[model samples]
Target: MGLVGEVLLLPFAPVRGSAWVIGQVLNEAERLYYDPATVRAELAALEEELTSGAIDEEEFDRREDELLDRLEIGLARPAPEN
Candidate 1:
């Protein structure tokens, strides 16, 4: 946008900035969520929880399935456009 356009939108700066921040947060979150290392770490943690009796078998199975599904779906997604 030109200088004149920016000046005209100055009053909406806060809203635009908020949207930018939200987009950044979402992007980062997706990056971490799909990371293979992250998924492995979570699976290890879930195993520990089960071992220590922090979670029951049913709960552990449910969570493990969800994590596995996320890993699969994350990998299956197409690369984002630059």
Candidate 2:
């Protein structure tokens, strides 16, 4: 299948494993796009999910990385070093 076909077929990939992860990742991006406090709250919830085994370590790690990336993009930066 072509890349577009593969992409279109993604939703049917039997990915019952990542329902919450999809939500979490989208929530992270949306919160980062809006409010830092909301992002922090979402991250806390993500951590809770990880601790409670609602999300496994690998999924946690992937979403954590994505959250951190969004956090980095959302955060303000200091002046450039000379």
Candidate 3:
């Protein structure tokens, strides 16, 4: 953009910065959410919960399915570039 265009958009710089920050945070959050290690840990915890009767069989099944789905999706994603 030219100097004139930049000057015109100067007032919106804060808004643009905030949007970029939000996008970064969202991307990081999704990366963590779909991380295989994290999902596996959650699955192990869920199994412990079931064994202790902290959760019923139905709840265990539902949560296990969700965790497996996350693991599958995470595995399917291409590795990030260095």
TM-scores of the candidates in the order shown = 0.75, 0.50, 0.95
- Candidate 1 wrong stretches, greater than 4 Å: 1-6, 78-82
Ranking by TM-score: 3, 1, 2
> Between 2 and 3, whose lDDT is larger?
3
Per-residue CA lDDT of model 2 for 2-47, tens digit only, reads 9999899888776744776898789766654646555677789999
lDDT of 1 by residue, 16-69 (tens): 999999999999899789876789899999999999999999999999999998
Clashing pairs in 2: none
- List candidate 2 stretches off by more than 4 Å: 1-34, 77-82
Candidate 3, residues 1-82, lDDT tens digits: the string is: 7999999999999999999999999988999999999999999999999999999999999999999999999999887766
Taken over the whole model, the C-alpha lDDT of each candidate is 0.92, 0.74, 0.96
lDDT of 1: 0.92
Q: Which ten residues in a row have the lowest lDDT in candidate 3?
A: 73-82
